[model samples]
Target chain A: MVPTNIKNFDTLVVGGGIAGLQAALDLGDQGYKVAIVEKDASIGGKMIRLSKVFPTLDCASCITTPKMSAASHHENITLFTYCDLTSLNHEGQGIKALITQKPRYVDPIKCIGCRQCEYICPVHVSDAEQGDFSARKAISIPFSTAIPQLPILDVEHCMLCGQCEKTCPTHAIDYFQKPEEFIIQAKTAVITTGFDLLPVKNNFQYGNGHIPNVIDSMQMERILAPHGPYNRVLRPSDGMEPDSIAYVQCAGSRDKSMGVPYCSRVCCMYAIKQAMLLSGSLPLADIIIYYMDIRAFGKGYEQFYQNAKAMGIEFVKAKVARIDKGENGSAIVRYENQDGSGIATADHDLVVLSMGMIPGWDPRSICPVSKDSDQFITSIKPKISPVLTNMAGLFVAGVAAGPKDIVDTITESGSAAMEAAKFMSNSHMEN
Target chain B: MKNPDNDKEKEAKKAAMKTLRAQRKDLIASASSRMKTQKKDIKAIKEFLKGKKATIPDIAEGIDMPKDETLWYIATMKKYGQIVEAEKEGAFFNYSLNEPEKTQEKEEV
Candidate 1:
């Protein structure tokens, strides 16, 4: 017999990124109860952390936050933030998911979002949300616009200081909090777990992330953001406005040695967008993109590439062989020119590596969802309906299915929602 | 009358907290040492910037520290309101110590 305390929903969304948020909103509007389980403390995902989107150049946060707010405010949607899906499987006509809510050490019911505890905390640690370019208090809200507005206490960095405990007006600090486990049973499930960048530390050719001025693309996004660490695009080494910048394309993708042979499908467009933005910010600075090929395969993408070229951003058809630290915090890029020229090296004030995407979640241990040779979740009917997974009533969407651009991810999410809704309706008729 | 289960749970929580504190002893000690070093560095930078505005390169050369680490410290201090950007000097911006009392008074108004 099922426990009376088990929460029930019509559909379960495995991620709370833009894909999951859109799926939940679509199903909720269709009058179905939805549950969104997110791994992070907030639901905005990587989209919220980005500066802008490619091709359209729209503000990523502006597009993501409204959907986040809608999903949180929707009557039929329930959010399970800071959660881990322990196990998921088919159970009698429904899908059962065992979830564990990680401890925040602060009582959620009592937290008033006043931020007094964060302000009073003394310990300062490297802030990962800002790409480790700045420091945050031991206890802090992840960002200024974090949805719950609640603070997380980093027990690893905490000094057991009684300041935050005393400063919290609602007495929300509870150092003894434990992880709570729960169960959710739903008629359908959508796997929207997103993608993570291949770590630059693993790429030895890129100086193994030891070069101070050579940073990943996401760190560049933070540097370009309005509320960024330096508040402007400055070289991380000496806080100087860079006189020359270079973007190394296919740094991780299309390289079999790095184990990610497939193209990430978005790096080229994004590097172009960042270069265009950089030119606008620093008119006199020289911006160069070293690439094997420019794959402008999407609508308006070709034009976007042309516009960047019209703006005088240099596009060199070359393959960067290796990067090394130069004198006085500069990065030296050695590349082979594709025009039959010999290998050469150039020094730049800063270098940005366009890293490839890897699967964010592995369902091998927890669930039996099948994966393609590329390691992303496989769709049984990819040509006709790409959202249908091998598991009955199970669907996949966004980067979880494959590496794709934001537009395709959003469109695929809607298709997943429709497929899930159809599966639920068919099951209802059979019952 | 209090429930026996409640008492047992409270006792278990207390034991867990004791274990956690014992485990974190080394981490706390290391953090304290780091904090001391950071305080010395910040003090040195502030002394150099007393009644003067300087760029990151200038401050780093003055304190005999690496420019990158100096920039990290300067960025953190600026975020926490310990310093403020003064004006642009070529490609770099000069930073000066922020007056906390006056800033607080202005906020109050």
Candidate 2:
């Protein structure tokens, strides 16, 4: 009896993003005992970050809000949002997962999302909501409309200041909060730990960390958002309204010599969108896009590209060779307008590297599966099975499986959820 | 204005009007029931719509209403006529229903 916190469940979904949320909903509807463990303090993942999703420009928040509510209120779902899956060990007729929950200090049961603590906390850090667009106090809301309507104290940034502890009318602050660990016994596990944007730290040739005006595709989204810092186009370095913005497509994808080899499906379109948004947001701004191929594949995507062109967003089919610092807080982006053509340089007030999806670094690091050349979890094995790993009773979905859009991710998620459920059902029969 | 044939036409017109009235009554009844629903039920509608399509058969099965009645009410509420768009298969019937505008009218206490 190794302190068996063995709570019983049929299927365990790791990750509380849309894919995980979808899987849990499907399984729970099928009358199976299901649970979700989210590493974040709240559920909605990168989808929440998006201003609007494509193929249909429906507001992302509008779509995700209901799913978030459903997850929070599901009958069969036992959601542990601020928990991490540390280890997966085989146990009684199934697998047992060691889950570690970070302390919010505020008891979710007792803590009414009253923002007294958020305003009082003096320890400020980079606002993740702003995508490091600006800094915020440690206890602030993750976003303006974060689900659960609660605040999390960043223990790393908190400094144990006791300033917040004294101000709580609800007495919600407990600086001595301990990490709670429990074992959830499940017949099968589905991993939807989703993607991370490949970092700009490594690729210095594109100005990388060397230039402040350069941003990632997600950061561009945040900047373009009405809620974001500056709420419009302002170069990070000078705080001046940018005149020219250059987009370097496939910064992390389709470059085997530097980053992942696959052409990240979303980058080209996101670049186009950001360009269109930039031109729309600032009518006079000059926007130039450097790309290998303009991959506007989905329905109405080509029209969006054409719209961008009509709006004076210049599209040059080229591979950016380098981005270096320029005069007056601008950056110089050099590229061949077409393959191996004569090189030319364009100076811009700001530049954006359209980043690509990388596999969940830590969770994928924890699981027993081989990664691909792109670091995405392998979809098919030598045994002719999709999403099969060396380990049994484990599956992956969303960008974890490979590069996919939101719709395909949900469909694949249903399949993954079913496969995990099948393992659970079979295990139950055997037991 | 006429004799037996006119009387028969009047009777058929009355019957068609009767059907319309019955369907409209059902639609009104559906609104009343939806009004009594909690905020959670409205929330549940969003979640339920994703998985359960609220198809004519499913609605009939769920509320234990006749399929014809369910179809009639749904069609009237949707402002679409009885849809023959997708032919009914063995167990599933593919039909389109316009989502009724959720009225804010109050119900009895």
Candidate 3:
């Protein structure tokens, strides 16, 4: 039997990523009770997975970890990780959300983050957090810096040898754990749902993910990350240290065929950032970025592009026609130079596709809020107030509203928190 | 007041159970032996990549295994720190045995 718990908060933030954490912290710091419902077991979101941010090249973890820690320990913030929000509906003056907590199989109350259970587990699974380039025990924490410091048992890969249960000194490993249901009532809601990358699977033009060295931008980030699977830049197909690398921009976005017609704002800068990191790591390697048009719209972004050029990272104004596997497992890129160079083909030891981003959550069935033409949550007053959603007392922030960078996302999250707090105060005024 | 036929049936079931348990033991032993033989193949891959940098196709050709199987082996070997990336040729990376100095230098960079 699953126990049903009831909780109340002044505001509810649906996501535990940077934007969500920011919004929660903003409200919580103001002494308003806030609850964060995170789909993942940890709260850092995509930011945590990243190696560094664009423009500044600052360490991504350095900026995100503190926010994660603060939100987790905030006096007025309650974090619900690994929760599936089933339904959110209006109830009287507040909104109520039904959430089902996925079973971790390890008792959170008793289990310590000692890692003994991880050591005793015999099953080894591909670590997706590290881009599947490394192995992790079946029972292990998502990462070393993951907040909450709890390990989850992957039942599918578990052998049921009772080894983890036996080795756990606290006897926190439960073989028969069940999901729990929880209800949260909040005066207002903030949707900070993030964005997902366009999948390379069955993308025929890009070799359908069959060409191993031709990776997506996110995979390139992992490859460039200090704690990446290999701890160095290498081609996935043959583990070769690449001497020549190419970045294909707009590979996933601005293409009507893929159904994502808008530009994914961060791809260009991230590609440049990764290229710069690659240059630092592989100084002898040659880097080329094939782009339709360079969008340096953000602050100091134009200079960042110029800096990359200054570092010998070649920028090619061309559209990649198709990527094919070349000899020695290299990627053959066919393209037409915008300068009327009819057609050309080049082979690069590695190819990175800057795929577009899509809304991470679809609210059609979950809530009454409408989505824009690009399928992101629609903001009624995007120009004047980007956080004001179509639904009353419901605000949208970050990539949930549209594709934006971390800087804009953080600013928008703060805006949403302010709006939600104002809405609560107005309600009190009416009462 | 037990029937003699019932007692005979019970004895027959116990004998069948004993045979099944022996079969289970044999299966476990066979699996263990198979695993031991598989280790030699992994060792062969490690030996082939010891000083040479080769792509997946190249390594598969050297080990005389299917490309998919060879890829899995490569991934596992890499996870266990048996191999390291040497260079990228085109679409494939050339992998060599993980040498301490080479990896350490790369890390410093």
> lDDT tens digits, residues A69-126, model 1?
9999999999999899999999999899999888998999999999889877767888
Q: Which candidate achieves the best DockQ against the true structure?
A: 1
Off by over 4 Å in 3: A1-4, B1-109
lDDT of candidate 3 over A136-156, digit per residue (tens): 777899987898898998766
Error at A168, model 2, angstroms: 1.5
A12: Cα error in model 3, Å: 0.9
lDDT (Cα) of model 2: 0.71
Indicate the worst ten consecutive residues by lDDT in candidate 2 chain B.
Answer: B100-109
Task: Return the TM-score for each candidate structure.
Answer: 0.94, 0.75, 0.85
Give the best candidate by TM-score. Answer: 1
DockQ of each: 0.54, 0.01, 0.12
Give the winner by TM-score: 1 or 2.
1
Fnat measured on candidate 3: 0.13
Better of 2 and 3 by DockQ: 3
Candidate 1 local lDDT, B27-109, one digit each (tens): 77776676677779988998899889999999999999998888888887887778888898999989998878336736844
lDDT preference between candidates 1 and 3, better one = 1
> For model 3, how does the per-residue alpha-carbon lDDT over B6-97 read when each residue is reduced to its tens digit?
99987986676465446456543554454455557667887787677898788888888866456656665575565766666774677788
